[model samples]
Target: CIHDTRIIMTFLLTATFILGAVIAGVYFFIKRIYSYWCRKGVEYIEPDFFYGNIKEMVHGKISTGGLFKKFYDDLKSRGLKYGGCYTFFSPVLILVDLDLIKNILLKDFDNFINRGMYYNEKMDPLSAHLFSLEDERWKNLRAKLTPTFTSGKLKMMFPTLVACSFGLEDVLSEYSVTQDAVDIKEVCSRYATDAIGSVAFGIDCKSLKNPDSEFRQWGRQMFKEGIKGIIKA
Candidate 1:
């Protein structure tokens, strides 16, 4: 009797394991390949679970602007109109209907103000910037800061921008004659870092001119992709 009971228990455990595995596999498989069901005559592609329609997004396979364009086009071509598709069960909300986008972004702006993107205050202060804030906080902050970036203030900044451009041009001119490819992103970033430094802190950071400059090195490093994103993600 003892041997028979042990054998039954082992069989039960095996069955349970098999059932769990089957359930999990089926869910992911369905999510990845068939998350979105067509609305009436409209056809739509599905997205993976957890990652949603974010395979290309999180991977940086395409620029965000381009991805939005693609998403819009896919839905528009199929004439989805006002229906939403799944980003792994989370609605992608294809606004092929122009009226809906207009209502959400411009017309009925009060209701759809908050976006649920990640912004860890402790981890990323820059990420906690105005656009990241939500609801009343965002509205109030925007109103408060509206006057800070006025046309007059921007006009005042024009000269500073010109000066920085000249500095960059000067630096670039020395390297242009050489046939070797220049890292424009790196050079431009250096110019930007130094410009922002001068503007914000009243510091003369000649990051563009001096390769060995401590500020310049850090400036370039900031633009370079590092372990930071990996850690954060």
Candidate 2:
């Protein structure tokens, strides 16, 4: 019994030492990543361990767009044309100057090409979209798809947009007659659905005609609050 107890104590001590080493390694790794801006002598928003600088956004207190705008304003107030932010452990650069943005996007286009999105074509084939693509692949795909967004194509779709606008005006006009107050959120969503469906997919969502249409329902599903939306936001 004494020998067995000794063996058990030794095993427990070894396991605890290994676990403490791992914890210390991870903490140091995270600290190194977070110290990137400091090493570069750049101003940056400080980040918490898990939520980073987006605590409000993570907790659903502010929207993703709102958080970005707030960060932009804060950086701008500091008279900074560019600064860094952290998305978890990843370093992200934010631009505040329009001229600098134009230079990066136009004059230095080649250097700023990749969007740095995670893409594994083998595991998720559809994940190879333009926004997620990088390098030669992105250039090739962009060249192929550029013609679709040309002014000529937009001109061809203009009439369809007009038709959708008329449909929205008619719906709002009819609604105002009986109901003084309108759920403008729903009305505008349906209008956008009809417009996008007509122009982009060549299908009329008929969102105004059928409020509970599958397309509109699917759009609502995209905003359903839970782990997915929170993570996305």
Candidate 3:
């Protein structure tokens, strides 16, 4: 019995030491990666150990865009023109200056081609869209699609868009009389859905009138899945 106890204790001690070493190594690795912006002499938001600056986003307390908007507001209030942040050890640059953003997006777009999103073209063929694609693929697809969105094409679609806005107007008018607090984000999302449904699918979704419309449900499901994936990543 004593011999068996001695062997069990030895095994436990070895496992504990290995686990502690692994934990320490991971802590140090994250610390080094998180210091990148600091080493580059750039201003950045202080990040938490594992989730970086997106703890709230990972916890589902805020959407990704909302979190970035908060970051933008915080940095702007601090009188910063630009700042860096971390998304799980990966450094992200936030541009607050209009001229710099314009230059990066328009004048010098080729230099900033990669969006750093994950997409497996072979496994998920549908995921290989323009936004997820990189370099030559993105450029080529964008070039092909650009002409379809020209002024003439948009003007032709304007009447359909205006027709869709009536549903939004009716809903707002009804809400105006009640004077109750409104979720404008949801209302706008429905409006956008209705607009897109009308213009693209040639189906009057009427999502603003019927919040439980099939298209609206689909949109909600897709958004929830996307946010869940972001949190998992």
In order, what is each prediction's RMSD in angstroms? 5.2, 3.1, 3.7
Give Cα-based local distance difference scores for all models: 0.68, 0.84, 0.86
TM-score list, all predictions: 0.62, 0.81, 0.78
User: Which 10 residues in a row give candidate 2 its minimum summed lDDT?
Assistant: 224-233
What is the alpha-carbon RMSD of candidate 1 to the true structure?
Answer: 5.2
What residue pairs clash in candidate 2, if any at all?
none
Q: Which candidate wins on lDDT?
A: 3
Query: How many backbone clashes can be found in candidate 2?
Result: 0
lDDT of 3 by residue, 1-233 (tens): 99999999999999999999999999888899999999999899999888889888887788888999999998899989899999887898898989889999889988777777666789766467777789998889889988878999899889998988888899899899999888998999999999888877799897999999999998786567345578534
- Tens-digit per-residue lDDT, 32-91, candidate 2: 999989899889988899677877877778877788898899899999999888877778
**Which TM-score value belongs to model 2?**
0.81
Q: How many angstroms is residue 162 displaced in model 1 relative to the true structure, after the best TM-score fit?
A: 1.4
